[model samples]
Target: MQLSTAVERFLTAVQLEYGYSEHTLRAYQRDLAWFIDFAEETGARELADCDIELMRGWLWQRQQQGLAATTLARNVATLKSFGTWLERSRLVPGNPASRLRAPKAPRDLPRVLADEQMRRLLARVEGRGDAEHPESLRDHAVLELLYAAALRVSELCSLPITGLDAGARTVRVLGKGGKERVVPFGGPAARAIDTYLTVARPALIARAAQAASAASQSAASQSAGPQSARHDALFVGNRGGKLTPNAVYRLVARELEDEPGGGPRGPHTFRHTAATHLLNGGADLRVVQEMLGHSSLASTQVYTHVSTERLAQSYRQAHPRA
Candidate 1:
């Protein structure tokens, strides 16, 4: 079969058979579209026509066009997956992109909060400075669990009330690919959550009294209360709807924007900072890997590079080898 036909079939299979989400399907489509354009520009025809030289030329074309390393990596991944699908479906004899190398992604160190900054961030989350504001207390719990659990923003936002085991200090998070893992946090996260559930959540429920006024209007109203208020949502918004991940991210970004010497804070910053802190405090790499819900130890190993850099700084400053 022709390369274009095979690519279409592969994408169809990914959508229908593999059950990939819309976002992933769109990404695959984009990557493959870029590859097809590259192939047309390079005068390549069939699947068998793609070789190491052709692949190298394609990468060079992208480089000359000034594609970022991240985009290049995604492009390579898309081609590789397409090649694999072609081979599996008997459209090609073998995978042509099996040996193709992608551009190396630029290494940027993960952002971490200094101990004092962490203290301040947590204090803000706990509403230590603004105890009367229900929103403040709720915000504190959200941020605390995010840092303490090393949860991806989506995972944190999707967290269910049943996932929390307060006595065990553990939370069961459903991560990428629907994989479930248990993550543990410390006393601060626990306390923050407890205060939100006890004090802030009820006030949020009360503020949503307008929602109650609609009770007699429909069956949806008769079923509404704080317990069943947000349809089992753990975090309720000011309007009594589920708090979205985007909203959570923006809230964190807003809080961090004002902090002294804190660089480019976002939702992921908490997870990165949490992982770095764990390694610094002598936690095992494998333990961190499991906590992070990483499929491979290699993915979790990046923080070791950060750890080594810190050690090197200490040796330079504190050692007398000179």
Candidate 2:
């Protein structure tokens, strides 16, 4: 079988059978595509041409090009899965990448906001411009729910209108691998969402309808009917479409541009801050794991490290004796 053909089949099988998320599927596709191009360059176009040596050389070349350890680790994982599938399907003699090993990437602690910084940030957002403005209300709700639920940006953007329970102060999130979890938030988030739903959402929808009508009128030859369908998303963009992850990223980056942080200034920073704050307030590790929709306890343990670091910093500053 051709190498490219084998990769397509493997990707399809993973998507259909394993239900891998789009992000994971895209990563797998990119890594395999690069590998296939490299193999073709070396005159290895057939699936049978792939071997342990070829795989190792590809990784080595990427390493020489200065790819980050985490990226290389993902590349190795992608190859291993592809090779395993090829072997099982009788396209190759054996799994060429079975013995492949990923480099140990450094586990850098996630950046988190201080309590005072968080307070100031929230206050600033709440006080920005007119509170009655639809955009202002929506932005406030977006930030409140992001921090309150410790949600991933993708999760936040894809949330449906029916996914939230304001009375229960909980949200149903469809996490990675299609797993669903219910996360609870505080009263502040509840109030913000309630206000957005009651006031801002309807106004935004009206704005969207007006925009769509004007577009249809200008392009009357294209269609005489409604230009777009009503979106059921919990959050909508300025044009009334469902909110996108990139939109959320821009909003977060703008908000955090002036904040003191050495790492990324994205929506994940709010998630890290929320998790660390929960740990600092004596929340249980397992409870937090469930809240954050982390499949493993180890993923949740990092917040404990953040909490400990904060405590050590306090002790260093307040201790009387050296």
Candidate 3:
């Protein structure tokens, strides 16, 4: 069978049989397509004819093209998964990618905002130009939950209204790999979310209702796609649509830019800062890990370096018996 025909069968099998999401299957398909294109450019025609040297050469070419270590690692992983599928389907005698070693990626520690920076950022949110604006309220809520719950951006954006428990100061998050965990927040986050839910969310939903009414009148409406627009989405776009990851990133950046002497700010910065602050406050590693929804203690341990540096700085300034 042709390489394209076999790959199509494998992808279908993975989606139908293995129950992979469309997004995951598409990503794997893209990565494998890139590999196939590269192979064809280098005079290779079939999966069975490919060798370990060809795989290494492709990786070498990617490195030469200046791909980041993390991206290269993902590419290698995609290929490995593809190879496994191919081997299972008898398209290849063995998995070539199993023997291919991924390039060592640098363990760059996540950057965290200092306590002062966090304070300043929160201050900006509180003293907004207009409290009545729903966007302002949404921004405040987004920042509060991001810092307070130590959530990943996706988790924060994907949160349904049903997951929040303002009375209990806890939120249920659907994290990576479909793991469910309850993360608690302080009074500030709870208060911010309360304000948003009461003042802002309704206004946002009102806009969504308006859009839906308008769409109902348009001639193309009947042929239009079902409103993937979730009116119940906790954080909504200005257009009353669900907030996308890009919009979340941009929102963070705009808020940071508005702050005085703002450094880098993103959704992940809050997660890193929260973890570091928790460790600095003498919270146990396991507790911090649970708060951040980290599957491994090792993943949470990086924040210890941030706390250690802070401790060393304090010791230098305060220790008298040196």
Candidate 4:
């Protein structure tokens, strides 16, 4: 069988049988597509021609090109899975990438804001939010919920209004791999979300409707086909469409631009901050794992490391002994 044909079949099987998420599917497709091209260029177009040395050469070529270790590791993992699938489906006699090893990607500690920094950030957002400015109100709620729930940006953007139990102060978040978990927030987040829903969301919806009506009446408007279907998403963009991850990234980056952080300034920083804060406040590791919707406890152990580092830093700053 052609290597490319086997890859397509493997992808289809994973998508349908394993229920891989869109992001994971895309990563697999990208990594495998590159491998297929490299294999063909090296005169290995058939599934039987692919071998461990060829796979190693592919990874070596990528390393020479200065790809990050994490990216190269993912490429190795993609090939391993593809090779295993090919062998299992009888397309190849054996798994060529069975012994392939991914490079040891450095596990950098996630960036987390200090307690004072978080307080100031929330206060600034709260000050900007008022009934007169709906977007500000939305922003306030967004920041509060992000910190309180430690939600991924995708989880937050895809959150449906019905998913929120305001009275219970709990949100039903659809996390990665379509796993659903209910995470609770504090009174401040509850109130901010409530205020946004009551004042901001309705106003934004009305504005969107008005804009659609106006655009329909204008002959030069290129977007005169039909108004977007009403969505139940908790968050909407300025244009009243479902809020995108890019918009959330911009919101978080702009807010954290001046804060004391060395790594990424994206919304996951809030997640790391929230996790570290929870661990700092003596929350159980298992509980934090459940709240963060991590399938493995190992994934949650990183926060413990962050908490320990923070403790040592504070001790160094405050202790009197040399």
In candidate 4, which residue ranges exceed 4 Å CA deviation? 217-229
Model 3 off-target regions past 4 Å? 9-27, 129-131, 214-216, 220-231, 258-264, 312-322
Which candidate comes out best when scored by TM-score?
A: 2
* lDDT per residue (tens digit) for residues 97-212 in model 2: 99999999999999999988888888888887354578888998999999999999989988998999888899898998889999998988888898888988877777877777
User: Across residues 1-322, which tens digit of lDDT does each residue of candidate 1 receive?
Assistant: 4556677888999888875655578999987777777777777767667665776777778889988998888778877887788778777688888988887898877777766788887776564525467778888889989889999887876778898899999999888767899999999889888988999888777777665665657766557542335466678777666778878878988888867754666898888888988998999999999999999998888888877877787899999992
Error of 1 at 282 (Å): 1.8
Judge candidate 3 at residue 148 and give its lDDT: 91
**What is model 1's C-alpha RMSD?**
4.7
Name the candidate that leads on lDDT.
4
**What's model 3's lDDT at 153?**
86
The residue-by-residue lDDT of candidate 3 on 186-220, one tens digit each, is: 99888888888788877877776676677876768
Candidate 1, residue 99: how far the Cα is off, in Å: 2.6
Alpha-carbon RMSD, each predicted model: 4.7, 2.2, 3.3, 2.0
Tell me how far the alpha carbon of residue 48 in candidate 4 is from the true structure, in angstroms, after superposition: 1.8
> Candidate 1: which stretches are off by over 4 Å?
1-9, 15-26, 36-58, 128-133, 202-231, 314-322
Candidate 2 vs candidate 3, lDDT winner: 2
TM-score of 4: 0.93
Candidate 2 accuracy as TM-score: 0.94
**Which has the higher lDDT value, candidate number 3 or candidate number 4?**
4
- How does candidate 3 score on lDDT? 0.79
- Ten-residue segment with the worst summed lDDT in candidate 2? 221-230
Ranking of all candidate structures by their lDDT, best first: 4, 2, 1, 3
